[model samples]
Structure formats: C-alpha cells, structure tokens
Target: MKESILLVEDDSSIAIVITAALEAEGLHVDRCDSIAGRDCLLASKPYGLMLTDVMLTDGDGIETLPPVRAAFPRMQVIILSAQNTLDTAVRASDTGAFEYFPKPFDLEELVRTVRQALGALDGSDLPDAAEDLGQGLPLVGRSAAMQAVYRMITRVLRNDLTVLILGESGTGKELVAEAIHQLGNRRDGPFVAVNTAAIPHELIESELFGHEKGAFTGAVARQIGKFEQAARGTLFLDEIGDMPLEAQTRLLRALQSGRIRRVGGTEEIALNCRIIAATNRDLVPMIAAGTFREDLYYRLAVVPIELPPLRERADDVEALSRHFLARAAAEGLPRRQLSAAGAALLARQPWRGNVRELRNFIFRLALLARDDVVDDATIEPLLASDNAAQRAGEPEAGIGNAAPADFATALDAFLIQARPEPGTLYDSALAAFERPLFLHALAQTGGNQLRAAQLLGINRNTLRKRLVDLGIAPEDALGGR
Candidate 1:
C-alpha cells in the first residue's frame, strides 16, 4: 500500500511544484491550502506524513500540530514556511515537527525530508512548545544556514556546555553568543564579554582571573576579573584566538577544574559560568602551528557553531536589509523602503565584509539617498564606487587581458531598470563614508584608538572626536572582531 502524505500550503505555484515532485517520487500526496481543509483531510483518512506551511488561507499550519499529533500519534509533521526567523524555527521544533524547511527551498531536499519522515512514522512522545523564548534576538535571517545555527542554540539552552562560535569577521559571532546566554539556563545571571584581542598580552591573565590588591604594579586596588563577574551566567571570550599561550593554559585549567586562582591571591575561586568563545580565525591551523593550544581548543569547542557569511545566504539579503532599514528609522534616521530592484542588486554583491558591511551600506543608503524608495539607481552608483575602491588596490596585470571596467555601465543599466521614488539625499556622502572608514580602521587595529588613528593617517585626538561625532561605541567600532 502506498503511504499517503498531506501537504498544506497556501501558495498555488509552490503547491503545484511540490505536488508534482512528490508524485514523481511514487508517494500519494493530498494537497490542501488551509488549516480547515487539513482538518477535514485528516479526519477522513490516515496519512504517514503532513508537510505544511506556516501561513494558510484561514489559520497558521503550526497551530494544528498539537491536535494533529494527539489524533494521529503515528503521523509525522514537517513545517515549511517563508517566515524564516528563529521564533518560527524554534516554534516548529517545539511542536515536535519532524523537520522544518524554510522556503524557496530545494524541491529535492523537501522530497528527501519527506521520505525520511515517512520512514519514521511511528508513535513517539511529541515535544511540548517552548514558551517565552525571549524578547529580543540579536541575530536575524531565515536562511537554512541561520536555521542550523538556531537548532544548535536551542539544544544548548538548558545545558552549561562550552560553545565555540567560528566565523569570519562581521558575521555576528557575538550575537550568537548573546543569544545562547540570554536564552540559556543562565539568563538571570550577568553576561560578561571580554575581547582577548583588544587586551594587551600582559593583562590577559589579570583580566580573566582577578588580582589581589598590590599584586602587580597596576594592582593598586583589588580587581575582580571576567570569570568572577560572570558567575552563574555567561563568560563570552571574544577573539579567543588572540589569547596568549600562558593565558590559554590558565583558561584550560579553570575549565577542567571549574576553579580559578586570582593573579596573586592564594585562595582559589570556583567558577560557575557558561563559557562561550568566538573567533574569526581558523583555530585548527593555529593549533597545528602551535600558536593556539590544541587541548584548549577542544575544551572551548565542545560544541562548535559556524556562522554562514552573507554571500552564502544571498536569499536573506532583502529581509536583512529591510530589518536594518527599519532599525535605522526607529533610531531617528529618515524612514525608507528598499525597492525590489535595489534589494536584488544588494543580493548580488559579494559582501566580503558580510552582514556588518551590508548593514553599514544600508545605513549609508538610508542616510544619503534622497528617495523614500531606494532603487537600483541610488544603490548602483554607490556599489559601483565601492567596487572601484576595492579594485583600485588590485595589482594591474594586462590591459586587454584584464577584467572589463563595466562598473559605470552596470550602474547605468541599474538606473534604467528602475526609477527610485524621490525622498531626500541631503546627508553629506563624505560624512556617510567617514564613520565606517574610521570604524573599519579601528577594527583592523583592534580598537586601539591611537593605532587606528595612525592607520587612518589622522591625529589620535581627531579619531576620538570623529568617534564621538559618529556616535560609535569603541567596542562596536571593532566590528566585534
């Protein structure tokens, strides 16, 4: 007998494509577009699997999971949705969903998931929904990449296991750390973040473990370190790759014993914080090079979570850009909307700087463009200019053999493609560029204002003044490197 599957999706085009694919796989597929229809289908016949989208004509598909499982305990449920957010994904997981697929998903993957779900159709304890996950999520995106990250975060929410977040700079590694801490068992406790790269090598030990008064030349007063401050909470060791070897040894000892000795104190202190470490650098190579301790790497990476760069999740660009634009408007920047053409343009960029780069670019667009609707015209000019800047540093090889200089032509095509709605482009382009330029320099210099100033070829005082003028936090100016 063929196993029957129920698919509840509102979009007809998606329904047709999915139905055709499932039919081709030799499984019986029953299509419905609403919760009501799904109910009728369920009551009439047995189904091995139910693949449903969150949004339906009448009601949410996920809301039916509890009831469906109660009635048909053996039936497996899988949620498919365009609403790709952590909340939606978590909720789907909470509903004992066999799997969750964010749309514009691959049909082949969907078929594969369906086969797996059908194969596992049996009575099991359906998990209850997680209530009140949190108020704010620093990370946003519904891409498969982000969904993978969310699942890992949920698994560690109740446990105190150490988490190592690995990603390129500007990929929101700290945001993942924050989410883990905020959504974890230690939500009530203090959350302390220490940028090991920003600290001098000599002070690394003193920073992680407090020092006794008069313990060292700078220890005129007794100081409590990050481990103590984050007791029963979370200790986020940002840029863990930059920690000195000596500090790594002490850190490993503390992780093993769950205890730390103050810099010069004879007494030992028991640490009770969940440790979350993040680094943009690849630690495996560092360990192989003996720059980073192998044992410490294993200790910190009990559960490793790698964040996807923006280029890898191009489907999420439009949503993320809108989110940032909304945030900018809420923070008193002029309100704006991104035209479809503009969003498509953004989705096409390499975004080497990743989310941080896209965010800053959006802010610049919001501030500089005179139009309420930012379309290709407004975006193309800026992108072209940026591409030119990035290309300027490249070594010139040959004239005819070189890549064609089509930046302006591309911009012109983009302009012709869409007419942006007029708004206000009154903000100075120089001012728009100045803050990010200085901030990038600061990040490259590891938040040392003097060094960043030197790199930018500006006076230290001038850099400080610019930082203040731009309302950029010293910590944030580092791009959370």
Candidate 2:
C-alpha cells in the first residue's frame, strides 16, 4: 500500500513541486489549497502525514494542525512556511508538528523528512480504520430509503466498476465514496479525491493530469497528477458536473484508453485507478443542454447510485438524531438526548439540507440546550423560524396576504393549485416547509402534542387533530419529525 500524505499549501507552484517529488518517491499525495478543502479531505479518508503552511486564505494552517494531530495521533505533520520564525516553529512543535521547514526549502529535504516521518509512524495511529467505510459511523434509522443506500453500497463494493452517486449537497455523497473505497479490494491503497468545482478552470487540466516544467507560464518544474497518485486505488471526482469540456474530453480518453499524458510531456502514463464520480446536478440534463459529454455520462453511469433526500426518509429521523447526539457526546460536548417531542419535531421537519444539515443543527442544540435532554420547545423555533422564512415566498405552504382558513386548509390550497407534476412539487415542498415546521414544533414541545400545541399557540386537541389530518402517525411523529 502506498503511504498517503496530505499537502496543505496555498501556493500552486510549491504544491506542484512537492506533489511531484513525493510521487517520484512512490508516496501518494492529496493536495489542498485551503483549510476548508483540507476539512473536506479529512472527512473522507485518513492521511499518513500532513504538510501545512502557516498562512492560508481561509484560516491559519496552525489552527488545522492541532485537530488533525489529535484525531490521528500517530500521523506525522511538518510545517512549511515563508513566515517561519522562532515563535512560529515553537507553536508548530507545541501542536505536535513532526518538523518545521522555512519557506523556499529544498524539495529533496522535504521528501526525506516525509519519509522519516512515515517510517516513524504505524498504521494503528490512523483514525479507527474508518469502520465499515460505505456504511459510515452509525448514522441511525432503518428506513427503507437508507437501507437501500446501504444495500447499494454493499453491492458496489463487490466490484471495481465506475460509479456515479447522485444526491443533493450534504447528503453524504463523499461518505458513499469512502464506503466504496474502504470496502473494496483496494481498501489498503490510497483514496485520492478531487473537487472539480474547487480548482480554477485554467489550472484544472494540469491539476488532474499534471504538467511538465514549462507546461504553462508558472510550471517551473514537473508535477505528478491525481490519476497517477491514485494508481491501484480509487479516485473520487466530486462535482464532476463542473469539469470543463476540454478537461472532460481528456478524462474520457483516460477512462477509455486507461492512459494519461501530462501537459507539455510527450510520454503517455498508464492508469490503474478506479473512478468514482459524484454530482448533485443531473448529468442527463447537462448532456442534453450540451454542457456535459453524453459519452462520458454513459461511462460513469455504469453503476449509478442515487441517494434519497432526508425528507424522504423521515422514518430514520429519530435514529439519526440519537446517533448525532451520541457523536456530540463522544466529542466531549454536553451530553444530551432528544425528548419524545423533540424527536417528533425532528421527524416532521423538511430537511432541505439533508443529513449533514441535521447533524450541524444537532451539534448547535447540544451546545445551547440547558439540560441533558433536548425537548420540542428547544428544537422547534430553530427549525421553524429559519425554515419558515425560506418557505414564505415559495409556491407551497406560503403565507401570503391571502391567508387560508387554517394551517391545513392553507396547505391543502397550496398543495392543490401550486402542485406541479406530482412527484417534483411534492418532493420539493416536503423538503421545503411542512416537514421543517412539524419537526421544529415537535422539538419545541419535547415531543408532547399538548406542549407543542401550546408552544404553537394552538389548542392541544387542535394539534392532535392536525397531526392526524397531516397523516402523521404518532410513531412517526415521535420518532424525530
């Protein structure tokens, strides 16, 4: 297995040089230009070593060092900075930095330091081996929708075919990618991922295929690309829809011929990597509109998998809520549980942002809730107020100057006239308002209909009647939404 290294430097030139040197030495490198990019990388896989600069556009690289070290205690880190000073070096060391190099240091020395760091560390030092990769850390709920995703992942892992995962943002697309990588035969190999939308358009071609010295204006040295680094492993391309037409042609060629040629280089390099591409956008539409290549679409869709949004899996809300709460507790936050009402509210809410959004909200609640138990009262306002604002002018469930008789009547009216072709509007609206309001209210009332009604300024009997009228069963309501 190739040792994996995360190169977190903002300078494109330096990143290219370091990546090439490391690859030349047979080490796998994942490059990140900012802290946010680093965070996204860390979420999907573990790295053997981390090389970070002191200053980054998004935040200080030092701030990233401590958490990374804590999470992967055995993983070594080296600080490379143009702003290197005694105080900076001391701070980096204090955060368990393996070594410090001043800016403009020798690439050979950097490579040697990396080798020593890797030799000094053991595999057991990485994060818990990413237990059950595709399934991810226990994310609750046995809803058929979630179960289907689990089953699909299981099937995908049994083969090496390309996969295209379709889902909205925050729907755990990368998690699905990770699961595929960890469960497959190449689990031991490095999993290198690239976000097509994140890199600048002009530089993206070189970023993926690499560039020889003088390939472009600032291409001062030879650079190895992601495809070569991910050899014998998985290469996850997130937001594949954002790849440019020119790059797409090259990528398709690589997929078809199993070879890649670096920019400004004459030699063609053979590729031995698996491809897993993901996108929230509809590729078929893009292809129809002449934005995405139809041939590439067919190639990526060999084993396509679509993820159901959270609102569609309302049955899993309670389970997911508890799972996130436990995760928070494990992270040393105040321990908290979802009250019956809170859980019900969670279940009913339209989670437009999906599971990831739910997790963030739970973390926030865990921090703010006064007691160990989070009730409907506490969760309701947060979901309803913010989500209600989002729903105000939307076609479904909007409260315009013309108010309907009651909440249900208004919903029915909105559902009737504003309904688009059956599935689209219902799915979109369910994701938009009704669900969020229900979840928010249930959370506020601690899962008690009477309390939730009182909180909503309605009679308890009315609340009960409305809950039934909305086809919300007691079990489903009490579960999380």
TM-score list, all predictions: 0.69, 0.54
The 0-to-1 C-alpha lDDT of every candidate, in the order given, reads 0.82, 0.77
Best by TM-score: 1
- Candidate 1 TM-score, true structure as reference: 0.69
Residue range 1-481, candidate 1, lDDT tens digits: 3289998988999999999999999988999898989999988989888889998889877776777877777788888988878777767766767777877788888899888887874524336453546446868887788878876876676678899999988999999999888777798999999999999999989989989998999799989999999998999999998888999999999999989999999999998899999988767655644558999999999999999999999988999999999988988899999999999999999998899999999988889989999999999999988889878876433211223223323323333344233432124434554666776777776899889888778899988888898899977876644
Residue by residue across 279-340, what tens digits does model 2's lDDT show? 98766645744558999999999988898899998977888899889889999999998899
As for model 2, its CA RMSD to the true structure in angstroms is 21.7
- The clash numbers for all candidates, in the given order, read 4, 27
Which candidate should be chosen as best, given lDDT against the real structure?
1
